[model samples]
Target chain A: MARNPIRDEIAIVGLGSTGFYRDSGGRSAKALACDASIRAIRDAGFEPGDIDGIVGAAEPGGPNPNEMSAALGLPQVTHFSSPMPVAVFALVDAMNAIFSGSCSTVLLYFAYTRLPWNSRSAAEDPFRRHHTLGVMPAPESVNAAAAYAAWASRYIHEYDARREDFGRVALNARAGAARNPLAVMKTPLSMEGYLQARMIREPLCLLDMDIPVDGADAFVLTRTECAREKTRNPVVVHAATTGLVGTNDEDQLPSLRRHGQHVVVESLRAKSDLWLEDMDIFFPYDGFSIITLGWIENFGWCPPGGAGRFLEEHWDPEAGCVMIDGRIPLNPHGGSLSEGATRGSGHIREAVMQLRGDAGERQVAGARNALIGCGGFFFNSQGAILRRL
Target chain B: MSEDVDDAALIERFPYVRIDHDSKHFYRGWLDERLLFNRCDACERFHHPPKPVCPSCWCASLTPTEVSGRGVIHLAMFLHQGPPAPGVDYAMAAHPVVAVELEEQEGLRFTSTVIGCPREAIRIGLPVELGWVERFGAPFPVFRPVEGS
Candidate 1:
């Protein structure tokens, strides 16, 4: 393995979320962040003074760690940073800081608000009018969100894949979202409905992409020893990592076979003692359905191009989700696709909830471990495995 | 003409893209209707979207060399809706975008729209060659289907 001495040492003692909404009723990203942060601090059985480390995701229009400390009035902080978004960067940062004793407890927060470009409501809101992308991107380039569609086309060509393969991912998420109150998209999705949705980017339709919504998710991480005192069944991070390749440029990426996700799988597999067989829940990020397929294939659940078939073979029509080997459920909390794109925070938070046996109706019976694959092919590919202590 | 173009003038030419010192040569090439990518002066390797130093050899010396811009389409997508561009009418049809793998090196590619081709005809593995279209009154590199391919 990869010398994961920090394994199982850091525990996510508390988690809080603002649920998710297509609109936050004119709430700013900072407001959403503060709501989640306060709940997480209280959930951890501590006041603001007990928090000595603050790690906030540097999401677009998000409050920075220093700003959060000022707003929440955290008495003092020894470690603080604003890591780039997609969730696991802040997660790994906070976990490492706790293990290294930079701070005993860290408030990790992710606040997401739809930018003007993506959401019409956000664009019309006068408060959000100041945010700009600076340089206007040409419609022709394969960058950011467009890259997934570009790559999905390549995937079909290389593997003879079908849109049906991608649809099942959406179908699964929608099914789960019907039961998850935190999800913004609760309408059950069918493969036919997926095909009929408006084509935002060809090969990937509106349903194939995650919905942009205003929300925040926060976590309180502390030493496992500290967590054991308050909660007997605390969720501990067994392994967490972020991965990248040198040629990460969207158009210049090597191929569909290799990219950031591949590196994350290699790193996570080495660091983790638990593998697929031991997992009770799977949370492959559905930022784009193509990403979920990448995670399924790259994680070695199936061959390079077999995620679609793997999902089909293991699909549970009764539950309307994929039940791997008639047991493990994929993204029981609906993931980013239906759960309103909390980046990967929704995935991590759901994992912790499932491990704590607090997922209510979505809870997996006797759940012990959860595996999460976050982000996508180019950059921000990350993975985490959480275990009940 | 490209050499005469200064950083400020180049920035004005390609207003849609963010250009810095390292990528200035790339946009300068666009003014003269040429496609340039950074080449490691030491290892004689090529890379695109211009980086400060050679990623292959970590060599400091590099040159923005022009290429034939001939390659096969590696990836393709159509945008039913996207940002506003002068010639692109998404309502008329879904705009097509493609990443053409340059023949100079494996896995090295440039992304742009393909011209002189119907929507249905554009596909991965189709042969394409460099073409230019004026955008904001400056040459913008694009791809067109190779004749008889």
Candidate 2:
């Protein structure tokens, strides 16, 4: 029988993670990444020397992309970019490389550590070195926060969203964390405990957010036919895309115009020909809990005001949430809230794990169709949908 | 002697003109606290973070409009890390960062803070009134959730 060309195409054959850690045990970012990559290559039943193409998510204070290429001792790299939402970008880059015949096998890697030795004290640091090290200074300056606060104040006035909703998101994640061994905040969170947490920014409390975590994860991508030769089962890359509308300039859509239209959701729906209901698992980026609500609404799971209700209804354990439907699991690996942020790589690694059917105890049964979304700064966003062929 | 005095004074000052992108000739000189925004006649849209040009129409035909000083709480988060300099006490109670939706503007959203109350009381969807504090030669806008509303 002649095979369907698209059905049996590019596939992810191997995956590895250094687990999620609050600290890296004193290893440099490259060292941590190397550890994960080596394991991934071996997991794919290939040797370290077998990889021809390498890609990575950009990390602050980590090895540069060129340096990683030199360290890996690859003959040449077909493609690379440190785009925000790194994991998806890395996968997209690898796909392009394979299609263009640049390299058949690719290694994608990421790592970070938050141990005190690995962590820098914010107060003692002069000139805020870590903040300045990234592509741009951290956007948490008083001016920027003030700008966001102004917007938050307006959102309160218009949409009638309440603090309880934000609290529910954090509490739910915290509660979910208690069940997962990988979560940093594994302690059970009470409403009173959440309310008592010191306020950082008005209307936003410490418990209402995720802390930066240190860890590493990697994956190997190759042509589906070649991948089938290596692994028992291969997850196919059904589709991948990234979107950026306006430049970083403040004037493009400004605050008013940008709020109503969600470009990321619109773009993904157009490209995939799948509705929110079609996805078996959702890995929407939760850089901020409020952002998750935005994703839920934007993805058309519910209308604008429907996110709070959706969470309240689906979060019940005894009732057996209908949203997941035994197939449509939402972040069973605890997501960024529980798994720690490997930058955007965390979400990608989770998707890969589910597709490979190796997500272990947290695995969703027969999760054939999966969706992942990543958003950056003020409007840069991307998404990819994958399937097990 | 008079010539020397005149030169000294002139060196310390220079003539300058403030350019306006929108026809909203609104300016504050730090006397009274007044909240204002710009409305575009072409698109019939209002803008916060008050810019000279209408964001929607990109036209200079913007007119100054006074706001009701009331808004709805949209979304809120307490960011512990990555705050910029000029740090006051660690807790920013709706002072530096908060998200708000205006009561008057249908879809306008602005990120600011609410002040004049304990930080713990700020709730979502709370009705808030605009407040201001002048510092470093500008009036910074903050919000205070309306009491007993």
Point to the candidate with the largest DockQ: 1
Model 1 residue B84 CA deviation in Å? 0.8
Best by lDDT: 1
Evaluate candidate 1 by giving its C-alpha RMSD to the native, one decimal.
Answer: 0.9
Q: What is the lDDT of candidate 1?
A: 0.92
Worst 10 residues of 2 chain A by lDDT: A133-142
**Candidate 2: tens digits of C-alpha lDDT, residues A153-221:** 444545677776666667666654555565666666666777788765555566545566756788888
Give candidate 2's TM-score. Answer: 0.71
Candidate 2 lDDT at A43 equals 82
RMSD of 2: 7.4
Write the residue-wise lDDT of candidate 1 on A84-111 in tens digits: 9889999999999999989999999999
The predictions' CA RMSDs to the true structure, in order, are 0.9, 7.4
**Tens digit per residue, CA lDDT, model 2, B1-149:** 21232433332221111223332233331123555567787887887656766766788777666777787765554454443424334444233344566887764655555667665676566788887764333444568878786
Whole-model Cα lDDT of every candidate shown, in order:
0.92, 0.60
How good is the docking of model 1, as DockQ?
0.94
